[model samples]
Target: MRIRGLTVTFGEKRVLDGFSLDLPDQGVTALSGPSGCGKTTLLRVLAGLQRPEAGRVEGLKPEEAVLLFQENRLFPWRTVEQHLTDVAALSGGMARRLALVRALALGAQGCRWLLLDEPFTGVDQRRAEGLMEAVRGLRVPVLLCAHESHTLSLADRVVPLEGPPLRRREGEGP
Candidate 1:
């Protein structure tokens, strides 16, 4: 997706200011920064969860994107299987199960585009690595927010965010 001179604010705090980015169509892109840098806000904007006060975003088809937020956001009443089944009707039951298995392997579950916010938060290294490996195997576009270098390396590109500005770091190519 492409964000052109986007601007966003929450009350008086300017979260993003004339920010622009060209996200690749495939592979993973990591968004990283110090605390309260608006990385999450940018992801919300891309997912249509939050609207930018001013700017243009293009090249993303609404239906094709899925977000895995920082909060589990899982229906506590539903089992993990149920959650995956709920969103995977298009992929069919078998496909959904496979996806779930993959997610569990990665310490996650439930969708493509995989907008993971602090995916490794609180998890031990071994488990986190397992989860990261699972995410890598999905072969779908991924946007991740992380602080650890190991986690950041899993992405195809790591973009550092500073308030409204963003910078890109090279990663192992597809």
Candidate 2:
């Protein structure tokens, strides 16, 4: 999506202020920023959850995107297999792996894009690597927000954010 003059305000606090950005046609692009800098907000915008007061976003629709948050979206009582059959068939050891299996399954469902917010927060290094690889093999594009350097390496590019709400800083590639 192409964002022009995007503004998100909560009461008087500006969450996003006249921000502008462009999501590429394909590939992974990681977004990094300090706390409360609007990285998650940006993902919500892409997911059509929160609307900017003034902005024009081209080439994005809620239906075309999926926002996978860090917290589990699964039911504690329901086996991963019940929600998704493929998760059941992911060889063994799925009991210890959640991020990789879930991500692979979601990406396999087919969508225009996925906005992942630190999808591997609780996962181990080894498991996170496998998840990153699984995410890498996805057919759709991904925009990720992660703090782990190892995990961030999985992205095709990085957009390091700074300032309140966030403005893309220089020195980071496009």
Q: What is the TM-score of each candidate against the true structure?
A: 0.73, 0.83
Shift of residue 121 alpha carbon in model 2, Å: 0.7
For model 1, what is the C-alpha lDDT against the true structure? 0.67
Where is model 1 more than 4 Å wrong at Cα? Answer: 85-112, 164-174
Q: Encode model 2's per-residue lDDT on 1-174: one tens digit a residue.
A: 687888888898788898898888688888877767888887888788898898877887778876776555555566666755634333233433554466557667777887888777767778777777777677688888888787678788888897676798767756
Once superposed on the true structure, which residue ranges of model 2 sit more than 4 Å away at CA?
A: 85-100, 170-174
lDDT of 1 by residue, 13-117 (tens): 888888878878678788888767888887788778888889888886444556656655545565556766663232233333334343444433334466677
Clashing residue pairs in all predictions, respectively, total 1, 0
Q: Give me the candidate number with maximum lDDT.
A: 2
lDDT of 2 at 116: 89
Please give the lDDT score at residue 17 for candidate 2.
Answer: 93
